[model samples]
Target: MFIRIVKMGFNPENIDAFLENFEANKAKIRNFEGCQFLELYRDKNNTNQFFTYSYWEDEEALENYRNSNLFKGLWANTKLYFNQKPEAWSVNKIAEAQNKKPAL
Candidate 1:
């Protein structure tokens, strides 16, 4: 799977507006083609900083979303609330530990 992480820093006064925009668009983002998972996180010490963690089937899926009108509209609204430029990363999982015990 391909993973995407985006970190955004919002102006304290504009945080609510950012949240409202995100809330309105999150479902559409999650339901987009090849999207496997979607989640949001906030910095422990900075309430105005947030991160989005999502999983896609592959890079092409991610690119398709980025090229879509949904992203264009959401990002246009979202960028207005940013305190600084957003940071993003695309990654691949190398390893993961299993939670369940194997058959003995």
Candidate 2:
């Protein structure tokens, strides 16, 4: 499995617009072929900084999504609001731990 992490910094005033766009398109993104999971996170100290953590089946799957028109449109809308250039990393999982105990 592979993970894609994107770090984005938006101008405080533009956050709402970015969020609206994400809210409208997140479901489509999550349901895209080969997408295992998707999540968004914010830096506590820097409210305007955010990250998207996504899991994919493999590099090929990731590239497929990146090459799709969906990504091009999303990127076009998202990039304009950035306070600084976005950073991204594609990585393999090294370790993970999850509880298997039943919920109490």
Candidate 3:
């Protein structure tokens, strides 16, 4: 699996617009082929700073998403609100551990 994290900083005045666009497109993004998980995070200290965390089946899957019309259009619209250049990282998933509850 592959993990992706995208960090974005938006103009304070454009935060609402960015959020509205995200709200409208999140479902489609999450449901896209090869996408296994998706989430959004905002910095506590900087309200205009955000991150998108997602898991993909593989690098090809992620590239496919980047090449799709969905992404092209979304990126074009999303870029309009940015205060600075966005940053992103794609990495191979190593491992995940979760706590389990014991029976009472």
Candidate 4:
């Protein structure tokens, strides 16, 4: 699995609009193919800063979603509200929680 973390800093004046757009599109984004999970997080100290955490099956699936019409629309609509160039990172899960085994 792949994890993508997008950090966005928005113009203070556009924060409300950004939230509205997120509210409208969040569900659609979560339902996109290869998306196993989607979550939004905000910096408690800075209301204008937010992060989107998403999990995908792989890079190809992520690229497919990024190239889709839904992304185009969302991107265009949100870009104007950004105060800084958004930062994105892709990560891999290297470990998983497992039940402990009894010592022999």
Give the better candidate number (2 or 4) by TM-score.
2
**CA shift at 47, candidate 1, in angstroms?**
1.2
| TM of each candidate vs. truth | 0.91, 0.92, 0.94, 0.90
Best by lDDT: 4
Ranking by TM-score: 3, 2, 1, 4
Candidate 3 ranges beyond 4 A from true positions: none
RMSD of each: 2.0, 1.9, 1.0, 3.4
1-104: candidate 4 lDDT, tens digit per residue? 89999999999999999999999999999999999999999999998999999999999989999999999999999999999999999999899999999999
- Summarize candidate 2's per-residue lDDT along 1-104 as a digit string, tens digits: 89999999999999999999999999999998999999999999999999999999998888999999998999999999999999999988898899899879
Model 1 residue 67 lDDT? 98
Candidate 4 Cα misplacement greater than 4 A, ranges: 96-104
- Model 3 error, position 77 (Å): 0.6
Local lDDT at 88 for model 2: 97
lDDT by residue (4-78, candidate 1, tens digit) is 999999999998888888888889999999899999898999999999999999999999999999999998989
Tell me which of candidates 1 and 4 scores higher on lDDT: 4
- Cα lDDT tens digits, model 3, 57-100, are 99888999999999999999999999999999988767779999
Number of clashes found in candidate 4: 0
Candidate 2 TM-score, true structure as reference: 0.92
Scanning candidate 2 in windows of ten residues, the lowest lDDT window is 90-99
